[model samples]
Target: MRMSEKRAKMVMSQFKFLFFVLNTTGLYVSHESRDASLGFMVQRIRQMKFVGSVALLAFGHRLTASGFTTSPHLSPCSQIQRQFGHSITNPTRFEASVTQRSLSTKPLEFPENPSPFSTIKNGILTLHHRLRNEEVLQWRALAFSFFSSLFLFRHAIDVKLASLWTFLTTSSSLIPRIFRTDSYEWVLAVSAFFFYIHFFWYADVSVRKASEQGKVHPWRKYRLQDRFEADKHRRSVELKLRRNGEIPSQNELVKNYSEVTKQTGWNWKAWTCEVWVYVVPLLTWDILSPRRHRRLAAFGAPTTIQVLRDITCGLLLYDILFFTGHILMHKIPLIYRTIHAKHHQEPEVRAGDVVRLSMVEEVLEVGFSIIALNLLGAHPISRSIYNLIITFLLTELHCGFDFPWTPQNVVPFGLATGSRRHHFHHRNGKHYYQKFFFHVDRLFGFFQKDDGSLHGDSVKPNPHIPPAWQ
Candidate 1:
């Protein structure tokens, strides 16, 4: 009797276990997603249920068989037991049919038109998916590096170097310049010619920044217009500004500077964007500006013909180096991905974007320029002139202003690579590797020809319209 009761209790526990297993199976089936398909989940749940049912059947069958064998005649307890066991054991015989029926049921389908909220949810999901991509992760890493660099510059330079720089400036700035070289003649000549380039650089950068912020003043602004006429439109605007020539008074000048300071601070950006761009080339020039140490660089002045000849020769040499190096940087995936990509990141060129290069590329280009000038054995006067022209050309190309009388357009169709073409090259880096001239670019089939057929004065980008350069 104790054996029978124990067997009966054991069967009851098996039924309870089966109940828990079936409930858990249903719970698992409830959850579904793109990853967890309905068909797959349902199949898994069915398999669990089938196994649980089989275990329950085996236990109940053994319990019922023992009760029936112990009784000689039919008893109420035995009859009830037998019936209960039949219900429990019957599932094993028919479970295959039940499983087949469940499996045959169609998987759920998503609604044809998702709700607005669902559409937004999908969009967000898609964006999240894309954000997880390798390229996006790389961008995130790059962004992190940039922000961390900014933090260091903001704290380290502003707190540490600024104090030292301030003290040095306070003491005697001229002393440092004088001490850099032995002769005062070198100082005077370098300052006399370099002043023009430095002044232009500072002014152009300040003006460009001011124009972007919509700061109106007396001077002609390089503003982006939504609608404009032909190339003549830019020329007409400039001509009108020149004809009027409304000079700002002292009060206006102070206010203009104040506005500029508000938009742009003399912080890390001013150093990185404005000062460092020209400073690198200047440092390079000091070493290679006048290689022969001739009297012309010290006391005497270079004649017009000498300046022109030096300019022509220096340009040819530098152009070859720049063009070849640029093409190589593009052609080599490793170099482009590592270094040149930094500069191309700013496609919409600004005055400061002219020298927006990696330290490696910046140093390389500077080397190219200074070496070319040294190889030509240029005088300081001619060297300065070459530097001035190159600096002006680069700055103007990046100024994002197109005028009919711009130096590139002023030079003629097939000669110089104009601001328009250079801007387009920035937009798409595949073509126009030559900076100043078209001779090499044309020969290399990388030139974008200005046939006078295409004309548009609108500098502002239209989001809906694709770039023609691309």
Candidate 2:
């Protein structure tokens, strides 16, 4: 039963009990005959009261029209006898003034128009109600608050991430000339490996320490008092001046952490068996294979043609490996947590921290570049550019700024370009993975835009099912 109906029934039941008490106390006479006993009158009152109570509670509007009247006479015996023509010559009436007074004094009073404050307050009470009733207001607030933060952060991170491009664009140019000699090929290969290893370690450390707590872990509280004091002042000022927005809840942060752990774990495992055991050895074989057949049929060899070719192949292979690995990572829910999800731990990854990923993430990063170079037969320079671009793009998208890429740059390129797009993925991680090339994702129809905006949009809340990681 609906709550209102149940409440009405309970009220009616209580009214019937009160009627029985009143009937017994007020109507009892000295008579003890079967025709007119106190018990009989009490029972009659109960029957009439039940009818009156149900009429009032169940169909109160109809009862009000009927004057809440069950009969004309005070007792049913007198009313029934009169109706049957067995007359009580001068019957006692249920005093009209007393009855009217009792009827007029109802317990409940319903207003035609509710108080304005309560109308406003109740309208904002439920998530469903807020979304449905005050949609524009909610949306405007969301966009105004969050989109501003998302864009600025995205731009800053992208600019900082541009530094990695220097390595790719500069070093790849040297590989073309050096690959001609066997000694140079080995040197470049070994050098590239070591460089990647150093970067991997550095990134791992940085990522692991990305948290605010992690930053202050090594020092004593007293030693870090100066930093804390400075942060406190800055925070106080920000809180005073900052615009209000929906603060990310603890649940949201935990969700991001869980996503990152999944990504990192899978990436680590894949790199271990996939890279060292399989990929590296395969590339080495390709390099060694060319040595046995030095005499090409007719083509003239460039200075570092062999070395460049090998490096290019390695780079292309890296891309394929990582891209495929990413696809595989999402295929099985169990593997997703330890491998591909860890990169999403930070809701707003800084540009300086782009390379700061788990060891597994590093491996995926290298593998992605390798595939682009190896399989596509791209030059070492091109491969390097691709790697640099990937790094910057990843950081920029993850930075969580709405205007991160700017107007011209905002052409959606999967999850790697738009901050608004990727931020949604980070916020809700069950979907929105393995989407970097915007056209590709668009072709596949994989986009999921945020519903709420700070200015003029409404957010329809999805079923509040947390992501698989959470």
Candidate 3:
């Protein structure tokens, strides 16, 4: 009887364990399926909303036109009389003139049988017609590219979700398996790939778009004096060289120091090197880091304190590292000439020109920031947000257009280094090396004021400096 009781107990325990396993598995599958269904529903709802809005707008326009056509055409005096329910026996000259003017200005004519669907159909046709235009098509392509890049970065959200799921499932383990499935890894890899492609491709597209639209940089006029100063300096150097009986090379003497007005397009070789040397290493490090998962878990839905901590830590660390790297790149002549100067090739900076850095410069500037943030144990979501903030700032700085409504204009302090300041840096590389904030530049006396003038002692121009160095 004792043996039988022990056997029954063991059997019962085994059944309980089996049931637990089965229940957990079912829950996981159900949760995943539910999430997928929700995403599909959300997408469908957005499409419906867009269609409904378009339809409503078309209907509203049609109704407005019909209302105007059908409304009673009353003279100014008659309208007053009707409102008061009294007839005017005789009108003064002014009243008669006003009545005649009102009568002559007839309401627009409309079709007797106006089709409500006509406006909708016409709107659709007009959309199609616009899409058919080459310029419109190019704009659409650029917009698609920009949004696609953003969408790629959005996979980071998925990675966060996966990390959360993994943490929940494997909480007992010492190191959680955030990327348990092959799909998760692939998503990250693809995200990295798209990021590099976007960095390389989008700048050129943006430049082309800007050119087509005839949208000049808001601060471009400020650059006129700088250009004149540069030109004057160049002429003085050439004349001095000639007076010394040292003939400068024809190429050197006739060098164009003006900011580039046209798109320089892509440097395929540099881009390929950037992908292999910088992007690959960064992505690999990301894949290998378990801390990424921890960050995601901690920051997924942070409290107010956590939010502040992450932002503060991320900004300070990134700024210190990036500013240091930037200054070094400028101070080191060989690095500036061979590496940093690649970025300065386009003196006339555009939205797409932000990522146009040499492999080494890119690694030092962007890579260091990311690595330092990760090392600081920032939440994965915070790191992602930091990257986004950096991207927006850099893009806007290089974008040339300083719209009054931009964050830099609104904030006007802290990390909101205005586009004009950055443009000054691009125009004169000897000044403004700070990335996130202006204090570093101010501290180092390299700060360029809003008026495109340097704050500190001006550096003498080197005649031998390469054109790209500017």
Pick the TM-score winner: 3
Instruction: Give the alpha carbon lDDT tens digit for every residue of 251-326 in model 3.
Output: 7665754444444454455445544665577557666763444434454443334434676677767777887877
Per-residue lDDT of 94 in model 1: 30
In candidate 3 the C-alpha lDDT for residue 110 amounts to 19
Off by over 4 Å in 3: 1-261, 266-273, 283-301, 413-415, 449-470
- Candidates in order have lDDT scores of 0.54, 0.41, 0.52
Candidates 1 and 3, the one with greater lDDT:
1
Task: Name the candidate, 1 or 3, with the larger TM-score value.
Answer: 3
Colliding residue pairs in candidate 1: none
Candidate 2: worst 10 consecutive residues by lDDT? 454-463
Ranking by TM-score: 3, 1, 2
Give lDDT tens digits, candidate 2, residues 48-161. 654554444344443334344345543323322333221122212222222344533322211234457978877768656665665344564555566566455665544543
| Worst window of 10 by summed lDDT in candidate 1 | 461-470
The 10 consecutive residues of candidate 3 with the worst lDDT sum are 455-464
